[model samples]
Target: MRGTLVLISLALVVAGVVLLRSKRPAWYWMTFGALVALVRIAFTYNSVMEACGLTVPPSRLRLMLARMARREVPPDRPPRLLRTRVTRTGLVLRLGLRPGQDAFDVAASTDRLRHSFRAYGVTSRELRAGVVELRMTGYDVLKRVQMPAKTERDVMRVPVALRDDGSIQYRDYRQIPHALNLGATQSGKSVYQRNLVKELAPQRVALVGIDCKQAVELAPLARRFSALADNPDDAVLLLEALVGRMVSTFHVIRREQRISADIPDAEITADIWGLPDKLRPVPVVVVIDEVAELALWANTMEKKRRDRIITALVRLAQLGRAAGIYLEVCGQRFGSELGDGITMLRAQLTGRTSHRVNDEASAKMAFGDISPDAVLSVQAISAERPGTAIVGDYSGGWYRTRTPHTTLRQAVTTCNDTAYLTPDLPELAAFRPVLPPLTPAGPPSLIKPRPRPVTE
Candidate 1:
């Protein structure tokens, strides 16, 4: 009877795990997955390290002692595991490297450690001189993105997506002044832009949009845009106006440059952020929905216009950051094939996010210079996963990221709610979109229905 009861309990436990794995993966990881990973790491760490060549030869003292005792020599020593932290999404293992071992050695063997620990993913970073941190995700975070309850958010930094390692992927303009976002049709590139706009709506920064697709993508959030252009001609004017604004902001910073030998070098002002808050110009984020539209031209006159637009873009990208202006250039594909100045403009964009592209060359346009591994990762993105992307930057690091599914209506609502926060920049006042007046709700009927109607 006891044996039968034991079998029944084991079956029940297995069934529960199967159900949780499909229905509530986070819960399952917190309860069962983490426990199993911890146990596996404890049991197989030494063997895995030895197999991966991550183990170090025994010390001379140990060898001498073994010889003196007339016993077999001790095995090589693996890195000492200092601590193991269990997080909501994964485990963080901190290891102290043995002499002559370094973080790169562990990084090279991350795949072995991942398989040994039975974790979904593993990543390593040097914490200090002799310590390295291994971040292991307990499950496939991109499969069903659930953004954590709290994220690191600040001025000009917004967490727009979740990385496959269960960390938030922030769109930080302060760190990377410009970004190139690429994706084919139906690849959720628009959705990613919406999330960025929604996140920026409540901030004090100014939003400038140049959506040459008849403003189909950005017009819904017109209430929050300080300056918007829906055509190439208008976009050129808008870009010129932004250049003017950037110049004016530079003058302001110069005027406020109270540089003195008494002040520390760090305190000396250079950018808008260094100026006093009252004297600082509001930051501007230029979002271009389709860069190809501005680059494509046939006629000589049209070619001149395209050159003007590209020139303006190149100027902004080359020198806009210090003047409180940043660029978010999005397109289906961006390459030298577009025009003479396309590659020059791309060089200035340090951040890159590539969704499902039609070809490897398109992926290369985004990640080729950054990381070859990222290019491969982007190519592996399936058509079924619209929001999944490979995000990277000049830092030479990349991650698989997926933005949570945000509907257009939700983004529009957020923009409307935060419309009042839009800054009025006098430089581009002419380009500010004129939104229709809101229809007022009618007043309640003053006269009550006749009692005879109720009787009938």
Candidate 2:
């Protein structure tokens, strides 16, 4: 009877764990997963390192000393575990490298360690000269997106998504002035853009949109846009107006550039951010919903229009950073097949994000030159997971990221609430969209009044 009772208790515990792991992953990690991972790491650390060939042979001095004392040969030395920290998601291990071992050696063996430790994932980075930090996750962060409580937000930086390793992924316009976002149809690209817009709505910045698809994607949030263009002709006009504004901003910066021997070289400012608050113009973010729409041209007149549009885009990508203008170019595919300047425009976009692309080539367009591994990672994104994306930049570092499911209604409400924060740019006044007044909701009248008959 006692043995039967023990078996039943063990089965019940196992069932509870399985249920918690599938349903409440965070709770599982806190109550059971973290403890198991810690115990595994402690027990399997040495053997896992040896099995993965991460153990370095002991120094000649130590071996010789052991032999001189008529003792057994010294075993290979694995990295010393300097510290271990348990986080909400997983464990952080700080390791002190052996003399012959480097961070790469440890990084290469992370897969083995992860499997041995039974972790969901593992990533390693050099913390300093002789130390490496390994971040292991106990659960798949992208499976259910719950953003961390603390995120780094700044003047032009917004946390747009949660990274696979339980860190926030920020969209920093200052660091990367231009970015390319690529995703196929039904890939949740629009949802990502909505999240971006909602985050930017409350900031004191000007938003200009070029949605050549009849503004269907951007029109819902038109209240927050300083300038909007829906067609090729109107888009050209808006681009010209933006160029004019950029030129004016440059002139302002030139005037304010007080270059004197008394002033330090660092103090001589060139960008708008360095100017006095009163003299500084508001920053502008230009979002292109479909870059392909602007690049594709059929006839002679259309070719000229396309050339003009591409030229303006190239100029903005090349010089707009210094004038407080940034670009967020989104499309299904932006390749050489699009046009002549398509590759050039792409080269200038340092930040790249690829959603579930239709083909390997589409993924390559975003991450080919930066990270070949990232291309493979992008291709691995399943169509079933729409918002999951591989995000990378010029630094060649990439991460799996997923934006939480944000409804269009929520984005529109956020924009409407923060509409007053939109900056007024005089140059874009002519292109501003005029939206109809909203009707107020009210209770239905119980007694219907007699309608006016034959009034006309």
TM-score of each: 0.94, 0.93
Model 1, residue 258: distance off in Å is 2.5
Q: What TM-score does candidate 1 get on C-alpha atoms?
A: 0.94
Model 1 regions more than 4 Å off: 1-9, 262-266, 439-456
Which residue pairs in model 2 clash with each other? Answer: none
Off by over 4 Å in 2: 1-10, 438-456
Tens digits of per-residue lDDT for model 1, 1-456: 999999999999999899999888899999898888888888888998898899899999999999999999999999999999998889998999999998899999889877877788999999899999999998888888888888877889998999888889999899999999999999989999999998888788889999999999999999989999999999888999999988898898888777887877776788999887778888999999989999999899889899999999999999999998999999998999998989999999999999999999999999999899999999899999889999999989998899998899998888877777788999899999999865535876788744211100
CA lDDT of each prediction against the hidden true structure: 0.90, 0.89
Q: Could you list the CA RMSD of all candidates, in the order they appear?
A: 6.8, 6.8
How would you encode candidate 2's per-residue C-alpha lDDT over 75-95 as one tens digit per residue? 888889999998888888999
TM-score, cand. 2: 0.93
